[model samples]
Target: MVTRKLAAVAAALLTGTLSLTACSTGSSGGGSSDPGDSQLNKVLKAGELRVAVLPDFPPWAVQKADGSFEGYEIDIAHELADSLGVKLKLVSTDGDSRLPMLQSNRVDVNVSAWTSTNERAQTAGFTIPYDAHGAGVLFKKGADITSYQDLAGKSVSVARGSTNDTILTNDFPSAKPVRFDAISDVISAVKTGKVDAALESSYTVAQAAKSDPELEAISNPPLDPQLVSMGVLPGDQVWINYLNNFIRNLIASGEDNKLHEKWLGEPLASIVSVQGNAA
Candidate 1:
């Protein structure tokens, strides 16, 4: 059922462009605030922190069958709310909805597995990256693919409007990208032999490989590292600064590494080092 829906969404995205609607309702947990109030002050006064998180991204954030969210980003959200002396309100989001939720004021911060890019920086303020990953291809174990160049003239799948989509569209023109609405769809397409391979985050590819012995992640001549960070609306230096400091504290106190180990089964990468400088 999900696959069929994703197929329709992908077709729409391919023919048209992705569209996001701002949420009409305010956050459910936070106290009401005047429209004119600053976001930082509003959250502080309301005693609730609304955080947007991806419900589908594993090891980062995932919604369980019981409707509860868990993973590294969920834990980080809890800590952020605690630091601010506010209750945490988790707002479920996806690749397309995460930024819109933040921009529409439906959430205070986006802790989704958001990678900081120059284009996104124009519209959103980002805390220093908490994690880093690179784009890679996930293919069947016996596939002949060994490098990025090997994908030329082949069909590859990617999540539409995602960093991987942009990478393939801009950097690898020879390969055809079968754009999907969700990463799960990309994985499904590859597993089912609907596409030759799938281009996505190395972490996601690794997780997929663990579940399916036939799948493997290839990073020979790795793509540019994507810096995963928390996002807020642009021009909020105060909030951005606070979030950055919070992230720094997480790293310095070793809590970040702990979460990484618990969820990813590995220590935090050195590339995700603490960035204490103000934004």
Candidate 2:
């Protein structure tokens, strides 16, 4: 009888212990002491911040000839890691992979010039705008295109899964979109005359025009001016808040402006508003 009683006691204690463990770990499965602090706590404990960036987007994020990354996004990742006192690991991703990486916990944040949209916000959290630019149309010089209306029945190229692609797909039904996996491919399509024009970030379009004499950006008002921000997997408010505060600090200290001038050779206001008031 005593043996059976002791066995029952042991089973009860084990069950109790497991319950406590599960509660302590919460749903994150990271064993976070505070359930709400999953990603933030994980990053702090791991001593590394994994960030997703687009490697082929020049003047933003690019993998150089030496297999190292440098650009505005890389610099911003460095700043984020420095503030967190953790090492930075840049995860090379294309536009289609950025949010997926975050959702899978493969990356803690996305610093890949992600534009904020209401549809995306349903699945991910976004910080205040650290950068902004409208979509610009890049076409061969002397092309008759002057506005979106001029592109009716014309083919436009854009990076797959990018905001530019979404804009082209939804807002410009009159134009056909040819999507590519990389920004380079999108531009190549236009340069090779495979497409009528390439719709891309205004900043990138301007850079492309500068390097190629035959390329020029349409003078029409930019399309779908987007506020670019850092993105994180939703449901982790703590991590989202931390990134939001980090961006606010950058703006308040004028570091964002410095980064703009350094890489883009222009002031912040030239591309986007300096309004950092959003929470």
Point to the candidate with the largest lDDT: 2
lDDT of 2 by residue, 1-279 (tens): 001232232233333331322222123312233433557767767889999998888789889889899998899888888777779899998888876687677998999988888987766677777888788899999888887778778899999888898888888898989999989899999899999999998888888999999998987778888788888766555555556657766765677888888888876763343455342
Off by over 4 Å in 2: 1-37, 269-279
Q: Roughly what TM-score does model 2 have, to 2 decimal places?
A: 0.83
Worst 10 residues of 2 by lDDT: 1-10
- Which candidate ranks first by TM-score, i.e. highest? 2
Clashing pairs in 1: none
Q: In candidate 1, what residue range of length 10 has the lowest lDDT sum?
A: 1-10
Listed in order, each prediction's TM-score against the native is: 0.81, 0.83
Candidate 2 clashes: the total is 0
lDDT of 2: 0.76
